[model samples]
Target: MSGRKAQAARNDELILQAARAVFTADPGAPIAAVAERAGVGISALYRRYPSKEALLQKLCGDGLKLYIEVTERALAEEGDPWEAFAGYLRGIVDADTNSLTIKLAGTFQPTEELGHYAMRASALATEIHRRTVEAGVLRPDLTTADIALLLEQIASIRVGDERRISELRHRHLALMMDALRLPPARRELPGPAVTDEELSSRWWTGS
Candidate 1:
């Protein structure tokens, strides 16, 4: 690629990274805040994203795409079904995709493109849950929808620094993983499992 084109690509990534940190912290943050966070001129950000909603759409689109890719990779991985399931959770937690869900929920309109990606990701996750349960490692009553909420619960935690946050997330995740695993002496969970319908309802427009 040409030098200018390459530089533009780098700048775009920087802006997107900044947008993730900014909007994921405060979805109400202005577009200019992203430019400032990215150390890019406001005019340049405008030239690329046009508006705050446009930037948000890009962030969600990119995040959804990354999530689908991670799920597909986890499914393709060789070894124990339990390992794949655990690895998948670890991957998404490290990706911190749920931060976008927590911070950007109801912040923007749902597009058909984003909806398609979400559906695909959900299907892939369901397949992983099925395989893990069939392997007798996961609790049978835990639904695929529960995985989403579980990850969200883990992602809700925040600590001193990025390194500390990651450590805490992984630590909590390991504990949660133990709880999720099937055990001989455990009693049945009392509540009804989360439904896919409820998961779908989170998207305001039914996308």
Candidate 2:
């Protein structure tokens, strides 16, 4: 790409990173806050996003894209199903996608494009869960929704800097993974598994 295009791309990435950090911390923050965090001129930010809602949509869309990539990669793996499942959970934790979900749900109206990405990501995740269960490793009663909520619960932990946060998340997630792999006769999770409808309703569109 040309110099101008490369610069524009870099600016876009910076704006996105700033927006994620800003809005994830405070969904009600003003658009100017993102520009300040990004160290970009407000005019330049508006030239790209135009509105805070627009930037929010992009952040959510990018998050769903990352989820899709992670799940799809896990689905394509040829190793043991349990290992694939564990790696998938680890990927989601490392990506920190659930933090965005925890902070941004219902904050912006979902567009059709975002809906498509969400569906694709959900389907891929469900397939991974199905394979793991069929292999008799994952708990039969656990649903994909449970895993999503579990990961989101982990993301809510904020003790220190990014490195410490990651260490804690992975540490806790490993314990949860072991629980998920326990013999069904020996352990049963309480409460009903969250349905996809319930999960989607957390968003503004309720789709």
Candidate 3:
């Protein structure tokens, strides 16, 4: 690449990094805010991404792809079913590493490349669920759909203060994991589990 082209690429990277951080915190953040964070002019951002949706598509795409890779790698690691399942839950909930994954999951519709990635990710998740069931970590009645809903529920836990986000998320996730195990190990989940209609209405699209 020419020097100018390389420089432009570097600037784009900086802008994207800023946008991801901003949008993960507030999905409705303006492009000007991202430009300010990137220390670049708004025009520079538009020249590359054209619109906010364009920039968001990039962040969402990269985040979702990384999510797939992480899940696949975690499944491959040697561990007991409980360890593997717990680690994968922690990984998906690690907003530091995949801020946009959970943030964008609601609004994320599968495009061509991302559609393929989603398929692979779902397959891996199914395999993980199978292993968990065979090992008797998760209850036999739990479905893959149930697992997906549980993760989404974990993401939707509203922290009263930003400082408490990690602490609260980890605590809630541990509680949920315990409830996923078979009885007499499993404690009774308060209220009913999330149903299909509710998940589709709330989480299948942006809140």
Candidate 4:
């Protein structure tokens, strides 16, 4: 890419980051405030995002990408199925609470990019579910669909206070993990475990 284009992309990212911070502070804040926080001319902001909804959509997409990256890293570094599951759940809740992405995800109509990111996130959760189940750590009766629904429900939470939200998120994830424990007879499934690649392909590419 040309230097000008690269610079424009950088500026756009900065603006989105600023907008995220503002939204996290107050989801109902004004577009003018976001532009001001971004340190960009209002006209320039409009030129890039066109409207408040568009700017919010961009923020959601960017934030989802960041969340996915963190989850992937956590999964890669951990060995224990329980630890990996906890890390993934905690990451999602923390990301939703702090990232502007979750703030705007439900409020605005999503673009294709946002939808794709959501699919990938859901797939990751499914893979986590499959892993825990296969490892005899979770109930064999739990399907990937159930895990996806739980993740969606968790992501939908909206708390006005950041501290309270953080605490609640932690408690909720812990409870969810604890509830995954299975009895002796329901320890394992007959089928193969779900791989990350399989889950990603099934949900994201639909192949």
How well does candidate 1 score on lDDT at residue 45? 94
> What do the candidate models score in CA lDDT, each in turn?
0.86, 0.86, 0.75, 0.69
Tens-digit lDDT string for candidate 1 (115-187) = 9998999899889998889989999999987889999998997754587678778877877888898763344
RMSD of 4: 13.0
Candidate 3 lDDT for residue 165: 59
Taking all chains together, each candidate's TM-score versus the true structure is 0.87, 0.87, 0.73, 0.62
Evaluation by lDDT, superior candidate among 3 and 4: 3
**Local accuracy of candidate 2 as per-residue lDDT tens digits, 1-207:** 999999999999999999999998999999999999999999999999989989999999998999899989988889888888878998999889999999999988999999999999988988999899998999899998999999999899675558767777777777788789945323333334435654565465535
* Superposed Cα deviation of residue 157, candidate 3 (Å): 3.1
How does residue 85 of candidate 3 score in lDDT?
A: 78
lDDT winner between 1 and 4, please give it: 1
Report the Cα lDDT for residue 124, model 3.
84
- For residues 123-142, what per-residue lDDT tens digits would candidate 3 score against the true structure? 88898889888987678998
**Model 1 spans > 4 angstroms off:** 184-207
Q: What ranking of all candidate models by TM-score puts the best one first?
A: 2, 1, 3, 4
